[model samples]
Target: MSENILDIKDLRTSFFVEGNEIKAVDGVTFQVPKGKTLGIVGESGSGKSISALSVLQLIDDPGKIVGGSIRFKDEELTTAKTSRMRNIRGNEISMIFQEPMTSLNPVYTIGQQLREAYKIHQGLGKKEGTKRSIEMLELVGIPSPEKRVDQYPYELSGGMRQRVMIAMALACKPELLIADEPTTALDVTIQAQILELIKNLQEEIGMSVVMITHDLGVVAETCDYVAVMYCGKVVEFADVETLFENPRHPYTVGLLSSLPRHDIDQDELVPIKGNVPAPDEMPSGCRFAPRCPHASAICSELPELETQEDGNDVRCWIYTEQWDGEKGVKVYDNETTS
Candidate 1:
């Protein structure tokens, strides 16, 4: 068996609008090792959520997985039949979507929603499914699971609703779990709790996790490996330790520089200059070259995601021998605005 539970290569998901194609996830590739967490970190419109959605073949009308291989447990997901996908989703793999308030059906009770997974995946009857649902709720640290199960989604607090979402995703003991911005609107204490809960649950279930988030703090706390995405592409991929200690891509460095560090006293956070480009207005060359301070003539041509000697993958011209710029260029100097 392969060590990677999920492997995506050259993924290209796009939305066809009025005579225009918006490449949301363009030529993306990454892997999630079994029993470990991989963090897909980036700002908004980086295609983190789209990539996760493509894994479940959940792209709606006007949007599609146009190209690339999505292999889950060596099974080709892109070509998998609807029936096969139905069996796989929430059975072997499950996802906790971004907003719990909207993700959960308001009409359905918590137990009804949770029970659906058990019923569909395990062939459990209503009584058995309800029993399992309550257990899952309790497992996720939701107090008064028996009572909460019968309550509607709106009845629960934001944190509680988020817990319910987690419970539903884990009801079938899925081999892989994709958590998309699980801590988005929650407070700091709730965020910490949610992250801790996920880590504990991952340890207990022995499931590989793909954590999609913009928060670097969450990545540092939970990720084993990190893939930094920017404007629909992965600019840098490395182990969490290596990524934190030494980020290779200029985009990655800019992201790190934007974060406020307690260890070092800084006057203010260094925000990355310029917003992400529109899908249609994407740069022909390196996507980040427009905002990169080190961009030069070589950067005008796109760079491949090449592997370095240290096993880190970076999609930048600075690491290549063809870099015509000055030798030993420091990416994180205080002077560079970007």
Candidate 2:
């Protein structure tokens, strides 16, 4: 098998609202290695969800993937026909949306929705589909699979509902699974269980996963590699360990510093300095320049994503040879900018 299951390059998804084009995903690039989980993480509105939507071609009206390429198992999804895409979605590639309540049809029973995928993809009979649906529920650790299959989504608890969503996504044995905040509204314990279940299922099925979330804890626990996005662009891309241990970009550093750690007690939780820039009012140069403490006049020009000697990519002037910080780059080390 090839090393990469999904390859996305310079993906730009735009929305035309009130005659102004808003670039929700701007020049984002990354790849999902076969059978490995890649976590796309950032604060909400940083285009994390838009990047995932662009992959499955699920962007609604006014928003469309306008540039770049999404290659899944060597096939270019950008130019793939709608018919082909329809066939691919839920069969070869499936997505678990953020909210199970909103994504699932309240009118339909759990079994009905789960069977839909098997029927459409494999042309399974009603009886076989029902059997497989129950099996999926069991695989995802939902208790009393047979009983749950006959029940509606509203009848199940939040955690159970999330498991049902996972079961539905994995019913057809998709080669790739895109989970958009799988644990969103669930309590902390339930969140851990859902994440563990996904990890266990991925190992058993040997499927590549794209976990889109804002929680760094989730990324550390579930992802092998991570892509950090800010203002519709990827600011950092590295393995989970490298990212946690030695983050390069100022934005990434800020995110790590803000995370609450039990190992060290702090007076209060550190927060990122400013809100993400509005799409219409994006900075002319570096999108994060206004908030980056290490930013200098050279930041007036956008810095391209460049590979460092450590095998990670960062988009910041601090890593460049042209860095002109008065305190040198040492201040960024072991020091919180906030």
RMSD of each: 2.8, 2.7
lDDT of 2 at 152: 90
Q: Looking at model 1, how many pairs of residues clash? A: 0
Q: After superposition, how far is residue 318 of candidate 2 from its true place, in Å?
A: 1.1
Q: Candidate 1: deviation at residue 275, Å?
A: 1.5
C-alpha lDDT of residue 92 in model 2: 89
lDDT for each residue of candidate 1 in 1-338, tens digit (9 for 90 to 100): 88899999999999999989999999999989999999999898899999999999999989999999999988999999999998888889989988777779999999898888788778999999999888878776788999999999989998899888887887777899999988776777767777887788789989889999877778888999999999889999999988877788999988887865433455667788998998878899999988998888988799999999998899999999999886899886544423
TM-score for all models, in order of appearance: 0.91, 0.90
Give per-residue CA lDDT, model 2, range 202-316, as digits (tens). Answer: 8888989999987777888889999999988999999988887778888888887776533334466678798888887799889998888777899989999998997889998
Q: Lowest-scoring 10 consecutive residues by lDDT in candidate 2?
A: 329-338
